[model samples]
Target: MDIYQICPEFKKGQITLRQTETQDAEELLNCYSDEAAVPLFNSDNCHGDDFYYTTLERMKQAIDFWDFSYKNRYFVRWTIIINDTEEIIGTIEMFHRIAEDEFNHFGILRIDLQSRFEKQEIINDILEIVNENLYQAFEVNSILTKAIPLAGERIQSLLNNGYSPMNKRFMGYDDYYRRNRVDN
Candidate 1:
């Protein structure tokens, strides 16, 4: 499917995944500014550094970059909202892995959340949505994500959502989880 035509808004129960906007800078700042929460964010795909925005200005800059990337067909990103509070709590960014090597034909998912919302249930719910639809969303047969070994909560959530741990011998520091359509 054409990337531009694939934008979608997803909602299941209390969580809503929608296109992020410039106005979200402040809330996103709040989510990423938490000193404790910053370290838990996974940034393996973010050009080697964690895309943690500690201030509103930085968050806005990141949002601009996200917009530029979207316009350039680089990736798609969405802000996660808690319906009850109507507040942005996290973000999910994903792109089709179009490399010529081992990662060919895979969708890369990057999820960053405020420490408070990093519960197994919540992670499973959000990841479940991505796992079920990402194949078609990115037109790939499988999806991959990275969760460090020290992130026990995240590892459990990935396991609960049909993702199997990739071999450590091949993955080293990138504790990877993979879900393929054929697995069903």
Candidate 2:
């Protein structure tokens, strides 16, 4: 799929995944500011951004950067919303990695969620949608994400969804996982 031409939306059960918008700044601020959630975010190779936006202005700035990234085809970021509450829970980012390392041409996925919603079930639900769609969206053979040992829920959800811990360091970073697409 040519994600640069059009971003797709995915919906199943109580979860909705759609391209992020400027108006999401206010609701997204809560997830970015959550002290407990900050540590769980995957900020690898982000040039030192920890994804902690404590204020509305900072959140807006981050959202602006996401927009710029999407426009430039640097990556695509989708906001995660819970249908029942209409609350913005987090975001999912995916990009086609271009590198000389073993991960070349792979899809890099980054999922950031509020600590309260970090349960294995909720994460499984979120990953279900992404796992079904992102491989084609990013046109990659496999997808990778980060999950530290401390992130038990995330690790379990990933394992349940066909992901396994990657033994090699990802561009000098550790605690990464990989899941290859199985051809039908």
TM-scores, in order shown?
0.90, 0.97
Give the worst 10-residue stretch by lDDT in candidate 1.
Answer: 166-175
Q: How close is candidate 1 to the true structure, as a TM-score?
A: 0.90
- lDDT (Cα, tens digit) per residue for candidate 1, span 53-140: 6778888988999988899888888999988898899898888877776768788888888888888877877887787666787888
Q: What is the C-alpha lDDT of each candidate?
A: 0.80, 0.91
C-alpha RMSD (angstroms) for model 1: 2.0
Clashes of 1: 0
- In Å, residue 12's CA in model 1 sits off its true spot by 1.4
Per-model C-alpha RMSD:
2.0, 0.9
Instruction: Give the per-residue lDDT of model 2 (tens digit) for 55-152.
Output: 99999999999999999999999999998998999998999999987789999999999999898877887788878888887889899999998999
Candidate 1: deviation at residue 18, Å? Answer: 0.5
